[model samples]
Target: WFQQSESIIPNHLVSVPHPYVSIVKKCTPFPIEFVVRSYMTGSTSTSIWKNYQDGVRVYCGHTLPEGMKKNQKLASNIITPTTKEEDHDRPISAEDIIKEKWMTAEDWQV
Candidate 1:
């Protein structure tokens, strides 16, 4: 269904045997997952509401202004990337990803 759409990127299937068995082309995945938040919520340390309550001026790579209320809409959308881990996903910054050589600037440019 998605292949019918020109705007959507489709995964290349390598092989298929039965309805339950199928193989797809392997692709290099970004080490971090980008999460965009519009409103403050959640209880984790990385959550905007919790971070704001704790007086965090900067979150991920976005600088949050002072005096923000819980569940309030942010001035703009914020992208918070989290590292995929076995147990817990940890919040990470774009700079950290570049500094740690997780992804190159050119790779992230697109």
Candidate 2:
């Protein structure tokens, strides 16, 4: 007989004991991550703020503010959903992401 090890468990895994596991429970794939940037200079904030001020709003299709400070907090932070690849982890505007089809128009509505 073999037993499963905790180290082999995936990070996203959530388990319930046999008696507690109910048939009514359902699992759904919610592929979404929300990222917010509040500080610039060495963070994602600078790039985002610069794009907004340059009239390049809408990264992928997300709208941003017209003008913002280097270290100023955003009126409302935005989200950038990226792929699982480490190289693909880069902050992008909603407009650019939407325009590139990385995100859908509906996704930007959030």
Candidate 3:
């Protein structure tokens, strides 16, 4: 037979808030998502090039012109917006999103 000893006072109760709140705050919405492509490789990089071939002009909203050479760097950087449901999100190049009727345009700028 086994017996357990009782403590005179209960151990201190520690309260911890939900971790999701912190994650959500850290993922605050941005109006632009920048995609930097260095070179064309057989992996995910190739997929981007293929999209261009398929007439998908813009990869993340930076337009790619016809006859661009493989492994060539884009003329400029790309900025794509995150979907509204994902964060306080919004679509790319949407005037309403950029103007920020939902949240402050200043916050989205970052």
- Count of backbone clashes for each model? 0, 17, 2
TM-score of 1: 0.73
| 34-92 per-residue lDDT for model 3 (tens digits) | 34455432233225565665666665445667887656776654444444454353334
Models 1 onward score TM values of: 0.73, 0.38, 0.41
What are the lDDT figures for the candidates, one per model? 0.76, 0.50, 0.47
> 102, model 2: CA deviation in Å?
7.2
Check candidate 1 and list the clashing pairs: none
- What are the runs in model 3 whose C-alpha is more than 4 Å off? 1-34, 40-47, 80-104
Q: After superposition, how far is residue 35 of candidate 2 from its true place, in Å?
A: 1.1
Whichever of 2 and 3 has more TM-score, that candidate is 3
Better of 1 and 2 by lDDT: 1
Q: Model 1 scores what on Cα lDDT? A: 0.76
Candidate 3: 10-residue stretch with minimal lDDT = 1-10
Give the CA lDDT, 0 to 100, for residue 42 in model 1: 72
Residue range 18-109, candidate 2, lDDT tens digits:
65462333544333445565543233433555555556566434665555566777565555554333455554455656776766888556
Total backbone clashes of candidate 1, pairs 3 or more residues apart or in separate chains: 0
